[model samples]
Target chain A: DTAVSQTPKYLVTQMGNDKSIKCEQNLGHDTMYWYKQDSKKFLKIMFSYNNKELIINETVPNRFSPKSPDKAHLNLHINSLELGDSAVYFCASSADRGDGYTFGSGTRLTVV
Target chain B: AQSVSQHNHHVILSEAASLELGCNYSYGGTVNLFWYVQYPGQHLQLLLKYFSGDPLVKGIKGFEAEFIKSKFSFNLRKPSVQWSDTAEYFCAVSPWANNLFFGTGTRLTVIP
Candidate 1:
């Protein structure tokens, strides 16, 4: 069984549009995170949620938002998508932040 | 804020060759370390982790890492690498139960 899974493995949108990516995990994990991988393969944290509460918000723009309706689901919504926002976004979950994480198959976003 | 540095951006090797990837972190107080691997078109998977045990930790796919507290380093090593082992590796650290800070990834290409 897939421990962590993401929906819409690929997305194509135009500038000024809005998009959302869904993520789920069955590992009974308490924490979920969103990370972005740029063209240079730099993986950086964008947001983190624990038990459906926002905990970490990096220096990301206000256009990006993350919502966790429950412990098992964490979704990312991007508004006013720009060309620079085009990148592969990965969703991950862990029992806790101190433990290792299980990442979902990334969603490749293309903004034109 | 915690940060991780991966010294090698890209590496290439032949099958059966030994491999080593360097990882360094900047954090004070207690910290947890981890290594994650992502194969082509696949999600990231945990390779190894270090959390206040023996400094050396082993993970799946014949990968191992040693945590040196003095130098604040967790280096991944493989005695022999196969073509299938080629992937992008990430180093991460979390000082506590909040968020994980990841390093710039190292892309490995093991040519057969």
Candidate 2:
């Protein structure tokens, strides 16, 4: 069974469009996170949630938002996508922040 | 300043060769460290972790890492690397319970 899974493995959208990526985990973890991997393979934290409670924002722009409906699911919503928003977004979950994480395959978002 | 630093951006090794990847972090107070690996077109996987107790920790695929608190380093190493071991390696730190910080990543190319 997949520990962590993400939907819409590939997404191509135009600028000024809105998009959302969904993530789920079956590991019974309490914490979920959204991360962006750039073209240079630099991973940056976008948001973090624990038990459906927002924990950290990571100084990301207001255009990007994350919502957690439950402890097992965390979704990312991007508004007015820009060219710079084109990157691979990864979803991950862990029992807690101090524990190692299990990551999803990632969603490749392309904005033109 | 980067929270985590992976100085070796790329490393190449032949089959059966020993491997080592450097990782350092700039953080104070108690922290949890981890090493994650991502194969081509795959999601990231936890290779090892350090959360206290023994400074040396072992994970899947015969990978191991040592945490040196004095130097703020957690270096991943494998005595013999197979071609299938080629992947991107990332070092991460959780300084607090709210978020995780990842390194820039190191691409390891293992030759047959």
Candidate 3:
């Protein structure tokens, strides 16, 4: 069984468009996170939610918002997608803040 | 702010060769360290983790890492690598919270 899973493995959209990526975890983890991997393979944390509560918000632009309706789901919505927004976004979950995370197969977002 | 650094951007090796990837973090207090691998077209998966205890941690696929607190380093080592081992390896650290700070990954290409 897949512990962490993300929907729409690939997303291609034009500039000025909006898109959303859905993620879910079945590991009974309390924390979920969104990470962006740039073209150079530099992965950085964008947001983190613990039990549906916002915990860590990195220096990401407001155009990107993460919503966690419940402990099992954390979704990412990007508004006014730009060319620079084209990168792989990964969703991850962990039992707690200090535990190792289980990552979902990333969603490759391409903005034209 | 805590940060993780991976020195090698890309590494090339032949089958049966030994491998070592360097990872360093800047944190003084208690921390959790992890190594994750993403094979071609696959999701990220944890290889090994070091929370506390015997600094030397063994992981799947004949991989191991030693956490040296004095130097703030967690280096991954494999005595022998196969062509199937070619993948991108990432080093991450969690210092205070659940959010993990990841290093710019190291891509390993093992030629058979």
Give the alpha carbon lDDT tens digit for every residue of A1-112 in model 2: 8889999999999999999999999999889999999999999988889878888888899999998888999999999999999999999887764666788999999999
Instruction: Write down the lDDT that model 3 would get.
Output: 0.93
Worst 10 residues of 1 chain A by lDDT: A93-102
Q: Can you give the DockQ of every candidate in the order shown?
A: 0.76, 0.74, 0.80
2 against 3, candidate with superior TM-score: 3
Tell me, by lDDT, which candidate is best: 3
lDDT of 3 by residue, A1-112 (tens): 8889998999999999999999999999999999999888889899999978898998999999999999999999999999999999999988775777889999999999
Better of 1 and 2 by DockQ: 1
The regions of model 1 sitting more than 4 angstroms off are: none
* lDDT values, one for every candidate: 0.91, 0.91, 0.93
lDDT by residue (B49-69, candidate 2, tens digit) is 888999999888999999998
Using all chains and alpha carbons, the TM-scores for the candidates as numbered come to: 0.95, 0.95, 0.97
Docking quality tier of candidate 1? Answer: medium
Best DockQ among the predictions, by candidate number: 3
